[model samples]
Target chain A: MTGNIFYFLTFLTLIAAVGVVVSKNPVYSVLFMILTFFALTGHYILLNAQFVAAVNFIVYMGAIMVLFLFVIMFLNMREDTEQHKPMLSKIAAAIAGGMLFVIIIAALKDVDTNVYHPAVFDSQIGLVENLGIVLFRDYLLPFELASILLLAAMAGAVMLGKREPGERNRF
Target chain B: MELSVLLIKALIIVAVFGVTLLIATYSTYAERKVAAFIQDRVGPNRAGPMGLLQPLADAVKLFFKEEFVPANANKFLFIAGPSLAMLTACMSSAVIPFGNTLYINGEYIPVQAIEVNIGILYIFGVVALGVYGIMIGGWASNNKFSLLGAIRAASQNISYELAMGMSIIALLVLSGSLSLRVMAEQQGQDLFGISGMNWNIFYQPLGFLIFLVCAFAETNRVPFDLPECETELVGGYHTEYSSMGMGLYLFAEYVNIFVASAVMATLYFGGYNFPFMYDLGLPHNVVTILGTVVLFVKILLFIFFFMWVRWTLPRFRYDQLMNLGWKILIPLSILNVVLTAGAILLKDEFFK
Candidate 1:
């Protein structure tokens, strides 16, 4: 049953990933991205990473995707209004994506499958206790660095987002 | 699990689903009746026995109304909006521990749906996903008013969720567990060495206050409901939604309220732990049933409080809503976490 569910989720995730690129409307693309995230969450659950699954659902589908949808809607975009890219640029973009995909596959091919094999995936690894210990004890410096980076990004956002007196009242 | 065990689990799931629907249904009537009573008028008295059947009538009316699809709206997304809203509204109920264990045929059955060790995180995650309902619904309506409502809802929910998470951090410090079941058990101790309920509300009143305020914002209730303000936004996010589509949005709010009330009660009020419950000298099954009733009473009280504040308080302006969430509640909740951590450390150093 679990294996069947995992395969089904994987199929759905792949389908949604294609849909994200294939859909014409930006809103539809966002919705497809959300579907893909849900499918990924299902895979996380199958691996007994319930905490990761839930957080992934909450952060991506709940918070970030909602903001994405907000921007798409606020712009009131239409398919007719889209500017077509040059054929050469489109071909180049596809090539770039393909190269990145091949690079990822080649890099990961040499890695041991046992790293993520279900049989080797300890159920306790996803528990908040164990995850917290590993994060704080073993990976404290990297975790703190990530936090510092996020703080800097947040400051940058506020600086850009704040309205200047001369730029106010345009509406 | 045996066939009978699976069957029992299935039955409980159905019961919980039905009860949640029933509660949501009656709450609409209760909100009106409460509003009328507050405003010095008879509310929904023409239906059946002081409008006891008003919600059923309302539901029938909603179903019969014309299902509208805006000419410019995204068809699939317009349909999906309400379905997602209602789905997430009811999803969090699975993690709530309704009562103690029931002894049936010499086997123990816990009065809860699936028990994930990260029960609290599960609830938070589901609650977070609920934002998509309003966001999608408003955006799909193809109306500027609806778009504004969606923006307000997204921003409000995101801001308030921070405070809510921080407030719960205090509870985690106090209980040292992420499971709601464990937190409830920790709060079930005797009050001051006597046979009384030891509720967490007494210890984490500041956190509770922050949680309560954030819950209102998260659910888009009064005093923070800028998204659906009638005067400014004209039904807010559901302006273009009609028929059962609109009905689903409204119904989801009631369900969210019921679930939020249940959460607040379980976290602070000792859940199903009644004061001196062991003193009753009842059978195990009977005690569990009584415990469930106690939890229900607490939930109902919280629901009433929600409605009371809704009718009594005025809505905040958009800026005010953001300011309250980002400035006041978040900072206060963070301070609460700091204080709770200090208290825990002091206890460990001195008492423990």
Candidate 2:
């Protein structure tokens, strides 16, 4: 039963990911991307990682995707209003994407697939209590440092967004 | 046994779904009645027996009305908007424990749909998704006012969610669990020599206040209801929506209110836990049933409070709404967390 669900979710994820790129309207693309996140969240739940699944659902599908939709709506993007891309950039983009795909396939070819077999599953690792202990006890320094990095980024954003004393024009 | 357990779970799920819809339906009638009471007028009295059947009447009217879609609107998304809102609104109730375990044929069954450990987080995720319905509806309308309403909703929901989560973190620290069931059960214990009187509200009043305010904003209730403030944005996101599309959006708001009320009761009001509960020496099943009734009473009172505030308060300007959410509520909730942590530490050190 679980295996069937996993396969179904994987199919959905892949289809939605492709849709995100192939959709003509920017709003449709954003909606497709949210579907992709939802499928990923389903995968996480199938793995018994409810904490990760809920966070992924909230942060990616809820907050980030809503903002993406917000911006896309504000732009009033339509297929007819879309700008024609230069042929040179299109070929360059295709080449870049193909290269990344090739690199991913090469990297995964060396991995031992047996580790991911259902027989070796460790459900406890994905639990919130266990994750909390690992972060605060074993990986405390790295976790704190990561938070500090986020804090610095927030400060940078505030600094950039703040208006000057004599500014009259609003962006 | 396993089959029976599955059947019981299915039964609970259906029951909860029915009850949520029923309460939400009545809440619409109650809201109008309360509004009329506050305004010194009779409300919906022409319906069956003092408007007892008003929601049914309203639903019939909505169903018979013409289905509408604007010429320029994105038809698929326009249809999906209110459906998504209703879907997310209904989904959050799965995690709320309505009562203590029910005993049937020597099996103990929890009175909730799903007993997941990350129940609170699941509710948060669903609540977060609730904004999508409004945003999609507004954007799909292809009107400038509708787009503005959608934008306002997105920002308002995002801003309030931060403080809501922060306030919840304070409660999580005290309870030491992410599950609403666990939190509710923890609050059932004795406090200050009164059995089943140990509510979180006694300890986390400030956190509760912040959460209450944020809930108002998150649900887009007045005075934080800038998104659909008809004075400014016509019908807001559902401007182009008609018939059941508009009905679903309105119905979804009541469902959201009901769920929020339940969450508040479960978290801080000692859900399904009544004072002197054990002193009566009642049978276990009887106590559980009574507790369930108490929980629903608490939920109804909260719903009434939501309407009460709606009629009493004036709508905030968009800038003032942002200021209250980002500047006042966020800082206050953060301070609540810090204070809760400090109090916990001090009690551990001195009292122990």
Candidate 3:
């Protein structure tokens, strides 16, 4: 039954992912992407990665997608202006995607056949405390570095986004 | 083996949803009455004996009103937007513990919908996703006003959410638990045998204050409600919504306010814990009911406070709102976290 549920979610996720590209309206495409992310969050829950599921919901569904939707809405692009790529380029892109998928599956198959799993699926691992312990204790340096990266990103964004006193001429 | 447990759980879910809907329905009337009183107007007293039936009449009117869709609007998304808003608003209530637990025939059933370990995170996640409803609805309206409203909501959400999360982090540092149930239990430690002083409010006063201000902003309530202010963006995000679509947006705001209030009560107001609750030594079922009542009282007080502020304060200007959210509240909340951590490290001596 759980496997069937997983398959259903996977099917929906894939459909939504495809819809993200196929949708003519940018608004609809952003919504489809949000739907895909939600389905992925469900997958995280099924894997007993509750913290990951929550983070995915907060980050993907909450913050990032909000900005995407905002920009799409702010631009309010009409469907008439869509720039369709050449058919040959689309075919080539699909072929490249298929190759990448095959490569990933092949790599995973070898891991399933050979490399022993070290991470046990203990439900406790999904609790916030344990996740914090691992992130702060085990990955402290990397976490700090990631935060520093965010700080720099924020600084750059502020600098670039701020309107100059002389910039009103453009508007 | 336990059909009764499943039945009870189902009943609780339905009950919680029903109660929330009922509360949100009446909140409209409450908001109007409070506004009228504040403004020295007579208020909606015509519906039925002091406007007791005002919400019912208002709801009926909304249902009977024209359901509109703009000529150029995206059909599917226009409909999905309000429904999504209402859905996410109700979804956040699932993980909240209304009370402790009720016992029957040697079985214990928790009052909450689901006792997920990551209860707080679950709520934060759901509440964060709620912006999409406004964004989608506003954009689908295809009006410039709607677009502006959606933009304001997106920006306001980004600004206030950070401070809100920071404030919660301060509470978590002191409470030492992410699960709402455990946090409530931890706060059961009476302060010198005093009842409510044992609450987190006594310890993390600054965090509670920051959380309160952010809560106002998050709900898009007055003093921070630049998003939908009539003088500015013209109905904000719901500028083009009519009938039940507009109704859902208004209803969802009340539900969000209720959820935020319940969270505040649960976190800092000792949840369902009453002063000298343990001293009562009451029976299990009795205690559960009492706790639930206490929790409701806290929720109602916060709701009243929300309404009172909405009536009393003028909406902030856009730049002022952003400045308050980003510059003032964020830094203060961060400072709160630092102070809380320092106090925790220095032991009881810091407070003494």
Candidate 4:
């Protein structure tokens, strides 16, 4: 039953992801992408990574998707004026996507699945207690560094996105 | 062999999710009433006793309302925008531990939908992606105001997320766990036998303060609600949205607020824990039920507090919001982490 659920979720995710790339409408593409994220969250739940799945919902579905929707609504691009790109560009894009997919599949095929068994750890290890202990004691430095990276990103976003007082007059 | 257990877990999850959705629906009514009262007017008292049935009425009204597609709007994206907002908002509650485990028929069943080890990080990661929904919706609307609103929303979320992550790191340093249950367990134990001193808020007061502020900004509540600031961005991102589309965007915001409040209570307020919980040593069923109730009450109180602040404070300017997030909160949170580490190290060596 679990395997069936996992396979179903994986299939749904791939389908939606492909829809995202192929859809004519940009908004449809984004909506499909959001569906793709939701399906991926289901996969995480199957792996027993409940926290990661919830976060997947929270971060991707909550913050990022909201932003995407907001942008799509704001632009209000009329379909009548939206001309399809040349066939050459479309073919090039399709070929590139196909090549990437093939490369990934080929790489996965070489893996020796028979030689591998899932590593055994205490079931409690995935509980808040064990993860906390590992995060604080062993991975403390990296944990702290992640916050710093976020800070840097915030700074970059502000500097790049915000309009300067002098520059506003030109508009 | 264990199909029953899984079934029970699924049932509980559905129940909690259903209840939360109901609460979110009413929260909109409550917000309108509260906003009215704050502005010195009678709130919705017409729809059922004192507006008790207002939410249901509103839902019906929205359902029957004519769906308007702008003449120039991208039809496909226009439809997708609000749906994404609603979907992402409701998804974050899945991993939260609502209560303790109840032992039934020789088996221990946890009350949470699921217990994932990296719960905190997972929440942060998912919330980061939520910005995309607004961005896509606004950009798709083909309205400049919507675009501006979307940009503001994106900028605000990205800015505040940094400080929020930092504040959480400080808490992680002190608590030494990412799992909500373990964090709750730690809070239940008294350090040095101090009565009623079991919460993380007492130990990491500064971290809690920063986190609370960041939560407000993250949810796009008032004071930090620049994304939807009416005077400037002309209804922000959802200006062109009508009928159920607009309803979805509005509903999603409240749901996000609910999720944020729940996370705050879980992280710093001992989740479902209460003082002298060990003294009762109650039956497993009672314990689980009581924990669930306590968690709900705490979340409600946080929601009330959110509304209270909305009426009390004026919205922050865009630049002011960014400066406060980056300049003040981020630095202070970093200082908190360093200080907490030193304090913990000292306590281990000298106090022992």
Candidate 5:
């Protein structure tokens, strides 16, 4: 049953992700992307990563997507008058994406799948307690470093958005 | 049969999501009424008794309202924007532990919809992605005001999320666990037989404060509501959205507020735990029910507090918001982590 659910969710996610890439309208693309996230959340739940699934919905779907929608709405973008991408660029993007996907699949193929030991999936491991232990005890420094990266992103955003003195009509 | 177990789980998940949706809906009504009350006026009493059915009325009105698609707007994205908002807003409650486990016929049923290691990180990761919804919506609207609002919202969320994550780090260090259930269990037990001092909030008050402030900003509540300061941006990112699209954005904000409150209650306020809760010695089912009720009550109080603050404080200026988040909160959070570490080391060396 779990396997079936996982397969279904994966199918939904991949299809919507493709839709996001292929859709002509940016708004439709964003919506499809959100759908993709929803499907991904389902997948996470199937994997027993309930916290990740919930956060995926909250952070990505709730916070990030809201920002995206807001930006798309605010920009009031007109239909693209620009011509479609050159054949070379399109082919290049496709090739790169295909190569990356192939590489990922190839990398996974070598892993020993038959060694799976199905323990009574302890709910405690996935609870906030275990996550806290791992984060603080093992990944504390890297976690702090992520904060630094966030700080830098904030600085960059402010610098980009700020109106410098005597820079009128800058758009 | 396994099928029966799966069905039960699915039903529970759907029920939780449904209840959250209902709460989100009513929150909108409550917000307006509270806003009116704070401003000293009769709130929406016409929809039903005390305007209890105002949300339903509003939903109907929104449905019947004429939908306007801007001439230059990206129609697909414009429509997708609000749907994304509503969908994502409802997604975060899956991992929350609503109550303790209930034993039925030798089977133990966990209160949470799903349990996962790295639950807190998952919350952070998903929340990080929420900016895209606004960015896409705002940009698709093809309106300058909307674009500006979207950008503002994105920047605001990204900024505060850092401090928020930092605040969580301090708690993580002290709790020595990441799973909400484990954390709650730890908090439930008194430290070294000291009564009423087991909660993380007592040990890490500064971290709790920082997290609370960041939570406020994360939810885009006032005074951090720079993205939708009506006087300037003219409804901000949703300027071009009408009817349900607009409603979705507004409703999502309340839901996000609800999620944040739930997280706060779980992390710092001893989720579902009350003073001397064990003393009651209630039946297992009753205890679990009481725990769930306690959690909801805490969440409601937090929601009320959110409304109260919105009425009490003025919105922060854009630059000021940035300064507070980056210069003030970030540094303070860092210092808090250092202090927590020192305290931990001292305890290990001297007390141990």
Candidate 6:
């Protein structure tokens, strides 16, 4: 049952990821991206990484994607309004995409699929308590550093978004 | 994971679904009755005994009404919108524990749909997704007012969700768990010699206040109903929706209210844990049944409070809503988290 579910979710994720790229309307692309996130969350759940699954659902599918949709909706993107690219540019894009795909395939070729043996796997490792201990104990510095990076990015965004004292409403 | 266990979980899920829909159906009647009482009117007395069957009548009316799709609206999304809203609204109830464990044939079965460890986070994720239905509906309508309403909803929900999450952080710190069932179980402790009265409301009042305010905003209740404020935005996101599409959107609001009330009761008011619950020498099963009743009472009271506030309070302006969410609630909830952490530290250092 679990294996079937995993395969199904993987198929869904692939389809939705392709949909995100190929959808002409930006809103449709955003919706497809959300579906991709949902499928990835299903995969996380299948792996018994419930904490990671919930966080993925909340942060990526919930918060970030909503902002993406919000911005795309404001842009008023429609299929009829789309500008067609030149034939040369389309070929160039295809070549760029194929090269990136080949690079990913080559990088993943040596990955050891046998590393995650079901017999030796610790299902409890993905649980919240165990993950929390691992994070706070062994990976404390990296986690804190990541948080600081997020904080710096947030501060930069605020600084950039703020208007000057004498500025008028541009719109 | 036995077949019997699976069957019992399925039963509970169906039961919870039925009860949620039933309550949401009646809440419309209750809201109108409550509004009438507040405004010195009789309110729907003709449907049945004090409008008992009013909601049923309303449901029939809604079903029989003309289903409308705007001329220029995106047909697929216009249909998908309310379906998504209703879907996410119902999804959150699965994580809530309605009562204590039931002992049947010497097996312990929790009175909940599912018992995932990340229960609270699951609900949060579902609630966040609820905004998508409104956004899609409004944008699909291709109406300026509907689009504006969707924008308001998206921004309001995002802004308030931060404070709501911050407020919940304080509760999580106190309870030391993300599972709503665990939180409810933790509150089943004795406090000040009173049995089963150690509610988190006493410990995290500030957090509860912030949470209540944000809940209003997140659910798009009164004083924060700028998204669908009839005066400024017509029917808001549902302006172009009609018949069952509009009905689903409206019904979803009531379901969301019901879920929010249940969460608040479970988190702060000692869900199914009334004072003297264990002190009475009642039979175990009887106590469990009584506890479920008590939990529903608390939930209904909170629902009534939702309606009471809806009628009593005036709506906030758009800018004021933004200011309150960003400038006040966020900072206050952060303070609540700091206070909770400090208290926890002090208790560990000195009280222990």
* lDDT tens per residue, model 5, B155-253: 898889889989898998888766888787677776666532377788888888888899888788899988888999998889988888888888888
- Name the candidate, 2 or 3, with the larger TM-score value: 2
**Model 2: pairs clashing at backbone N, Cα or C within 3 Å:** none
Q: Which segments of model 1 are wrong by more than 4 Å?
A: A114-121, A163-171
Instruction: Write down the TM-score of model 4's second chain.
Output: 0.96
Q: Write the per-residue lDDT of candidate 2 for residues B202-302, one digit (tens) a residue.
A: 99999999999999999999999899979899978888888999999999999999999999999999999999988889988888999999999999999
Cα-lDDT of candidate 5: 0.81
Per-residue accuracy of model 3 over A48-152 as CA lDDT, tens digit each: 888899999998889999988877777758878878899999999999999999999998885655443557536677767788999999999999999999999
Q: Each candidate's DockQ score against the native complex?
A: 0.77, 0.91, 0.82, 0.38, 0.29, 0.91
Residue B106's lDDT within candidate 4 is: 92
lDDT of 3 by residue, B7-52 (tens): 9999999999999988888889899988899999989999899999
DockQ of 3: 0.82
* lDDT score of residue B236 within candidate 1: 88
Deviation in Å, model 2, residue B61 alpha carbon: 0.7
Which runs of model 5 end up more than 4 angstroms from their true locations? A1-171, B1-11, B191-197
- Candidate lDDT (C-alpha), each: 0.89, 0.93, 0.88, 0.82, 0.81, 0.93
| TM-score of candidate 2 relative to the true fold | 0.98
Tens digit of per-residue lDDT, candidate 6, span A16-125: 99999988778889999999999999988888899999999999988999999899889887788888999999999999999999999999999987787889879889
The reply for model 4, stretches above 4 Å from the true place, is A1-114, A117-171, B1-7, B191-197, B281-284
Q: Compose the digit string of candidate 6's lDDT tens values, residues B1-352.
A: 6788888889989999999999999999999999999999989988888889999999899999999898989999999999999999999999899998988767889998989889999999999999999999999999999999999999999999999999999999898899888998888889988888999999999999999999999899998999999999999999998789999999999999999999999999999888998899998788888989999999999999999999999999999999999999999999989989998999999998
lDDT of model 4 at position B48: 92
DockQ-best of 1 and 6: 6
Candidate 6 segments whose C-alpha is farther than 4 A from its true place: B1-7
DockQ score for candidate 4: 0.38
